[model samples]
Target: MNPQQPIKVLLIDNHPLVLDGLKALLETYSHVEVVGTAGLARAGLEVALRTQPDVVLMDINMPQVNGIDAIELFQQQLPGIRVLMLSMHDSREYISTSVLRGARGYILKDVSTEEIVAAIEAVARGETYFSSGVSDVLMERKPDENATPLTIREQEVLRLLAAGQSNRDIGQALGISAATVETHRKNLKKKLGIATTAGLTRYVIEHGLN
Candidate 1:
């Protein structure tokens, strides 16, 4: 995240040609460094741990662990690293899920190299960056209307939980006990009809609760 340092990048894509092309293109920029590349999300996770890159350029479709699912892994294991999804699909589900799982940005494969570089830099700086097309697609989705509304206390817990805080962490931040935090978490899931942490996070994001 230091301005003087070059942004270290790791590329993860199933296609060899895509990896090669991205590496070749990104290497042309002096501000960016290609740290490593992987053909799978698990392999990419290993490389990311080892290299500790500033940003990760990950494709959504791959064998074993797909990129959308892999985002949570990166978030849990390497929370400091920014993940920028590079995918061909512009589906709303994919974009929403990527953000829910803690991806910093989502960009299509067909975007210009300049845009890709911009996204990496933005995410590395702790900012979100979606391509113009991706942003447009996300803007079209409407919030669920029939969902139960959350109380003020529930909203606080949900926001902290979505920010990746543990029960103890949320409790300390909100001046509540861990047990209370857990109860709030359970109530949140029930009220939202969401089962997983990621689901709750997506709900918080979609509803602008965070």
Candidate 2:
């Protein structure tokens, strides 16, 4: 494992197109070699055990045996192999869970190619990496070190919205303009990973914030 040597890598994603895209993207780097790929967690673990890649680029959500739960399986077969999660989820719960499950880094799918390369390289080198927004979510200080901390304004908006208030009414109640209210609405949605009012309401009730 020379520092200057090209990194050996494996990719595990359910989508064939995504695997192709990642292989093509990774091949462009002389320092990165795509040793193997698999569309299933079991197959990927098997390939990983055989290929002995330095890093495993894993997708979080697969049809069966999600990447988070599979991290330990991979470790059992390949103890020192680092895993970098390539997921669309930026929520604190997912990121925290992945880290707890032994992911070395987490980056969103929307990240740029440069970022993707950087994350792979960093994680392969035994360093942690997170996309900018993912880092923001992780850096947010929870109430007691594990609580998901939403902004004060976002909480206010979520409470009012869960109470069946319109955006206009919420804005009026919060002393902010409707436009500002809309901005807060979008931010909270992104942060909480809830897109609809119904989903938000469910979240409100589930968390006992109602």
Candidate 3:
């Protein structure tokens, strides 16, 4: 990921129009290169392996293998390659599942072309990016009444963790050590009665912690 090199991108969507339109839109940018396109998740995986794209812009709805499930496949095969979900589905379940499955960012397909490019570039840089629509959905969820309240810093850590950030990345953003981030994570889990990272993410999304 040289600063000078254009960010390579792979587009995966079931609709041919969406794939073509996005590829055309992204190609106008000097910083982005549309390396390849696929209409299916398995095919996208093959293309991704061959092209070795810096970022993957994937749709949630596809034939046979959906994008949410495909996320883990990409992560398993291409460890450091960033996956940014671009889909029309904005449901919290879809978004949260994508995060749990290792998506770096989630954006609606209706977003502006520029915003899509921004999301791709941001994720390619190893930073999480969520569309305003996705953020709004997360914000509308109400916390459970009986849930224990968290400190401001703990809430910050929970929000970042739910947004698919690594402990090191969260620590860098909050000006804390990775150990401190882990401590906050443990505290959040203890307070929320959530054991796994995926459970914590689902709780944060359901409670509007974002």
Candidate 4:
């Protein structure tokens, strides 16, 4: 492959070993260029802005600022740069947050090097990609899948509520205000057509929201 046409890539992860391993794996692809790497979200943001890479492989858990928050910030700063979340977490919350934050792809850290490279290439070409194991986490819930539509935040609140957390607890866990938690609860109830907390709990149980 011609060096002049290589696809530029930026990698961000808090772990040094993971960063080094990813660099090694990605370098084997002759058409890909590892433009830069960072171990913190702030440094990643700066590198991304300065390098303007075609794709970013971002880790979900980072010191100082998380990958989901960084994704939103990077999208605002560098519109059109594709973000591919690479993380050890396969939980719905992390996957959903990535999509909501404008990430074009999500892949597990354990995925094969070939899949990671494919994900980066696909995302850089304006296509969405998800690791085979994580695809279900990205599926948009059908309108009828629930009784009504829930905003992303409301769904997050609902999931936490179903885990038997108090409003104050949920607020602290989500970094939101207790009053905001109450508002979310009200909105969830209204949208789901539930009249009571018992009803909400039942809905959550039925849908496996927890």
Candidate 5:
């Protein structure tokens, strides 16, 4: 058989076992090549800079810096590289945060190897991918009443802000950073034209979003 063209990939996760398993699984795909692995976000960033992988599979709950943070950083540094989050948690906050932070795809760790490979390939082609369960959760929420409806991530950030969480707390809870939370807050305020905390609270209550 003629050799298939390989898609370069970088795997990032704090756990060695998870990284090893993912590397092995991805290698099974004829079109995928595991170029490198990193145990933390910073190391992953360096690897990405050097290897310029077609796709990066990132784990969300890593030490020091998480996948969401890495996505923003990597996108700014290497605009051409695609980041596909590989996470164990399917929480609304986690999935929404990754999407908002510029992740091209989100796949659960428990997904089959075939699905994971498909997700990586799809993302490398500049498409979005979500595991079946993650897609269901994302689709469960109906759009808000506002004519210019907020995205899933913006809505979640607004809800958390309305509940009196600080930016740092929101970041910690959502696996993002304080700067990202602040940026989302600014965008929400601009879009909704509601700047004050009281105003946001009132808006949420008026719209029955709470």
Candidate 6:
């Protein structure tokens, strides 16, 4: 697909209302065209195979297969198909897992039409886009209690975490006890409002802090 041309988009979601709303909203954009829409993963695959759209706006949960699982398939069978996940969830596990599995973007269903359109265009251009719920936690400055930026040691721990380092390994590398490393880990979680290691990793990488 030419970068300058209107991007062909395919919508795959279980909710009829969502599909209808998306179709109607996208119809207003001259640079984007909704080529097809599907309510199930199987149907989505069929639509994709038929339409060969440049981008896919897919929901996480569908009838036959979830969007994350289907991402690899589209990458394999429908090469060059940029997928921007349309989900109501902004959980770190959900969003990060989708990106780790090759999804180009993830946006919540509550997103503004402009945000949705921006996400589609960005994803179609081979860039990554995360909704406010996800990006705000990482990119936006936090309040007073959370205002303090991570310390050098905390940043080191985060980089190691992004590198897949275990607590013991991080301790060894930092010349600190594993218990202290564990403490730093917990602090990291509290400060970042992140629970899973994957979430921390994603935050670190996305902010280029790793």
For candidate 6, give the lDDT of residue 121: 81
TM-score of 6: 0.68
Candidate 2, lDDT over the whole model: 0.81
Q: For residues 117-167, could you state the per-residue lDDT of candidate 6 as single tens digits?
A: 999888876677878787764443332364569999999998877655678
Question: What's each prediction's clash count?
Answer: 0, 0, 0, 0, 0, 0
lDDT of each: 0.86, 0.81, 0.86, 0.79, 0.80, 0.82
CA error at residue 150 for candidate 3, angstroms: 10
User: Which of 2 and 5 is the better model by lDDT?
Assistant: 2
Q: Write candidate 1's Cα lDDT for 96-207 as tens digits.
A: 7787667878999899999999999988887778898887766633434686677898999988887667899889999999999999988877767677776676566556
TM-score of each: 0.74, 0.66, 0.73, 0.66, 0.67, 0.68
**Cα lDDT tens digits for candidate 5, 1-210:** 113558889999999998998888778777898999999999999998998888999999988988888887898899757889988898877876676566778899888888988897787776678888887656532324464878888878887787557899999988899999999998877778765654564455446564
* Model 6 residue 95 CA deviation in Å: 1.1
Best by TM-score: 1
- Indicate whether candidate 3 or candidate 5 has the larger lDDT: 3
Task: Give lDDT: candidate 3, residue 11.
Answer: 96
**Residue 205 CA displacement from its true place in model 5, Å:** 28
- Pairs with backbone N, CA or C atoms under 3 Å apart (clashes), candidate 1: none
Which residue ranges in model 4 land beyond 4 Å of their true spot? 1-4, 139-210
Write model 2 residue lDDT over 1-210, tens digit each, in one string: 678888999999999999999999989989998999999999999998888898899998997899988888987787766999999999987876676556778899999988999998888767777898887775532223343678777888988776556789988999999899888888776777666654565455346564
lDDT of 3 by residue, 1-210 (tens): 888999999999989988898899899999999999999999999999999999999999898999999998898899877999998888878987798777888999889998999898888887778899997765533435698788899989988887678899999999999999999988877777676666677566455674
Q: Residue 60 in candidate 5 has what lDDT?
A: 93
Candidate 6 deviant stretches above 4 angstroms: 137-210
Look at candidate 5 and tell me the lDDT of residue 50. 93
Which ten residues in a row are the worst by lDDT in model 1?
136-145
Q: Which stretches of candidate 1 lie over 4 Å from their true place?
A: 140-155, 161-210
